[model samples]
Target chain A: MFPGKYQAVHAAALTVVLLALAASGVQAFIFSDPGSLYTAAIPDSWIYQAYHSTDQLAVFYGEGDWDLLYFEGLGKVADQSVRELAERSLALYGEPGGLSGFQLETPLLPVEVGGLQGLACAYTYQDERGNLLWEYRIFLLLPDGEGFSIALGSNGPWVKNNPPVLEEVLKKWQWTD
Target chain B: MAVDRLRKLSAWVIVLLFFSVIAAPVQASAASSGKAGAARFERALGGGAVPEILKQYGGEYVLPLGQRLWVEEVFRRLVGAAERQDVEYTLTVLNSAELNAFALPGGYVFITRGLVNAIGRDEAKLAAVLGHEIAHIEEKHGMNAVLRQMGLTVLLEVGMLAVDFASADLLRLAGTTLLELISRGWGREAEFEADLVGQTLAVRAGFDGSGAVSLLDGVLNLDSEDLPMKVFRTHPDTQERRERLEANLASFWPPPAAVDDPQVLERLNGGRILAQAGRNDPRGRYIVSLQENGAGLHIFDLQLGESALWLEGASVRDFAWSPQGQYLAVTLDEVSGDAVWICDRWGHVKRQIDLGRRRASQLSWSPEGKQLALLISDSGSQGILVTYAEADALVPMAADLGVEYSTWLEDGLFIFTGDAWYCISPPPVVPVTVQNPVPQVLQRQRILSPTVIKEGSTIRLTRPSLTMP
Candidate 1:
């Protein structure tokens, strides 16, 4: 159980949200999928199954929420080119109702995780109505030459409220190669 | 004169009637605002009620449940995959914007809609959160808190009545919502421990172990500006956790690379849809009395509109349920006193357990329903866990963690929230002798005050002394 020490902090946080509202009325927001930042082409089926299997996944019921799974199959692609993949994915999936326009950050961070090369990026989108929807994207470049992208976007009125369940579908995506 | 009087009366009557009609609608509108103005509304206004405010703000929503059910089902499957016990677990939707999740003893896990909504978009991050909370339950965090708060005798006593002492402590706790407690935003060591366990679980389940880092990193970013301050203020400092995670990654997944499982997200989304249908109806019958938000035990029949099967008094803190559903055991103490009142399901005083001049800090019941445990301390430092029987016979089982609170999972396994746990076997079979523990060290450690314990047939308490320190 949380102790009495945290009341002030939460109370303050509440004030911040309220203040944000006063400055700008509550607005809807969403994200455009940042294109695939895959290092190389990987089979989508393996990516899909990793998302499908319930055994190893956890659907967090908190912020940083997502459906997570591991996959194998993608060979490494050039780091910069993977940004193109992310752009493509965003162009295909990021239609802008929950978000305005989506933009991506670079993806060269080396992450220690399952044997796949990890690509991390951030997305900024405006909802169709034009609110700020911020999404942080994580793409795992698998060992077998395939890659899967994990995008977290919010569609909530304040910012965006995209539920992490979207990862399940993205996980299933495979490469033609 | 008669005609003039009649005309005047007529005029007055017409004016009164006209005003009444005008006032009616205005009054109704004000009343609606008042209802929505309450604290609950504040909660709703945050993120819980986002659907209604999306257009007002600038957010998009996926119609028909928002994958809430998909997330639930996906988590459930993972729970099953992890072999979580088959017990009736009810989830309360906490209305907060912070990243938090916690499980109360007795299969009760409360996750905020904010958390649910957030998890729907990212599979790995979602996994990290679920795995962490599940680990808390798996590791018996609730039970441990009970062990650290109360002792065994009062635990068994309140068990029959569904009482909990931790409520006061939980209320006394610093945060406004339960999420803070689960996230251990206060830098709780137990929280860090849960995170560790969660990371291992994620890896064992074939997830990228670093998911925790991703999740934490994302959570840290929510504040936007206070990144450093927030990280330092919360449990396990985000950066340190990431570094530690990098070191531990090798032990679990070899090569430690990022892997993708798109299917996991698909199932989660599907599960979220189904779960949305099953979400609890806040308008149901078991309404809290208008006088109190939630003071004592709040129980509703499977069907709403039914009478509350049981309720406890305000000062009568924390309780545990009987495995057989026959009774509840509760602990009662003055806001700041040395006496602890043990009560039963019907709200009758069973007997008072005295902590020898010092007030009892907490009480707990073992899963077996036969034995009880008590944690008595004064001024925070001195504490001990006394294993006893509901029959008024007390016995000393183990010491350490200062026995602040205790809860039983089942049989010999019980978690003392202070430091470790005590696995009392065969019902303690003999009576316990009470002893006075030193009070200094007890005050420094964080302990669970109001606690609840629920255990099934298969749960085992193998360790005698499991210390957190």
Candidate 2:
């Protein structure tokens, strides 16, 4: 009787391990592309789409009013410091009264992405209909003199509701090249 | 036992149903929210006006019309004076302190307040700056530059797509090409051509053609450590350009006359304004002249000796000093017509070459100071006429509708034009029939800034030259 019990327990443990492996594989399949210049692990519930072209490569994920855009090879800036480039990147957002009232939520701070030094900041703005929106941005300088940027935006209330998910997404971002 | 198991399964099914009911609304709300966010983002990027976009990027400045009245007036006068009037021009004064001026498609010209203030009170210099931007518009140099950048075939294909579908990406590509042109600057040849056209337009509009030189001088005076300045980076070789301007001043316009009228002399002497001075004159005295309220040329010695009225009852457009500084070639704009006067150091008219009806331009004195080459134009027909101080006749050299610009070669053997250098052997005697000689092609490539320099017996040109047979 004890022998059979031991066998039963072993089989159950193997099944659980297999299920965990399948879940992780499904997540990787949905979120990551090894052939791309960069990849990120997105939440399973979000929709993912990739845009590829000679000039630009981008990945966009959306769920409800929360959206994230990861851009690689976004063109070049005149030889300038990465900090200045980050400031310029912030200017791409439409100003107040149209789509967003641009306000700095967090000052630019040093961060590391893909083992390369970069800058990260958070900003808040009002949408066209006066809804409070927030965005987190990361700017990285590539070795090839090109720049990479990431923008994660969502309604203020949604971001407040899902802090852990947002942090996980940010943590999972990786640069392949 | 079967009843107990069925009861447990029924309880589990109820729990699943309860969770689905709670989560369905949340998923639906998220989908709707995502759609809305996407729409908002697309609208934001796609619908903003260019001016607003430019503002967001700190690319423009808001200057009141009152503050820019003078600039606007000068710009309007230049636009009215230009030969091409197909497009109405709008001028904007950027708020930045950078010394830059540029033109956009649809006849929009932008000049920084720094450039304007730096130019200050010198209307003619302002005209030179504006005229350059206008020439870029008139010649469509910007478009040509973009075409060169994007390749003609590819640009044309994208242009078709832009027109047919109004595709934003194609339009954006075109816009990017234009921005690059502005940032990188037009080719050196294009820049030189614009300079020529600009000075011509300024002179035609009754502004001093030398203002271009002065403007460049001001640009060179700017702090170079400000490396972010677009003018310096985009415009290469400022020193070379200044040298070219000096050469052009000597080759094209007449030297400034020496003003001698008592009132004009008093004003100039009191203000210490030496309008024109010969470089390294042996006598240690300079020739100074001033226009008497835009009507007469009053030439005198800056040493305060005696004042003499050089030419009365006529407006002087330009004047130039001979290489030896003995004679002054004065171009007068008269009520009757334009005339070139050769005056001595004493402000006496030694000889007069009346260019009847045909406007006289680009008076160049030969190295020996014996022959003066005059470019004469009438009703769009242009020809070169060589004049001698000893003789009253004009020797016709080369006349063609295609002659855009001409300069006297150092040896006095040829006149260099944009396409070819025409060999003009002076007539053996005065009052001889005009001889047309075949032009020797010095440069097979298109010459942009064809500057002819005479170093001893060697003739050096700005562009590459072929062996002259």
Best by DockQ: 1
lDDT of 1 by residue, A54-74 (tens): 322211112222212222222
| C-alpha TM-scores of all predictions | 0.27, 0.33
Give the top-scoring candidate (lDDT): 2
Interface DockQ per candidate: 0.02, 0.00
RMSD of each: 30.7, 34.7
lDDT of 2 by residue, B331-362 (tens): 77766788988877555687877777878876
In Å, residue A19's CA in model 1 sits off its true spot by 68
| Poorest stretch of ten by lDDT in candidate 1 chain B | B436-445
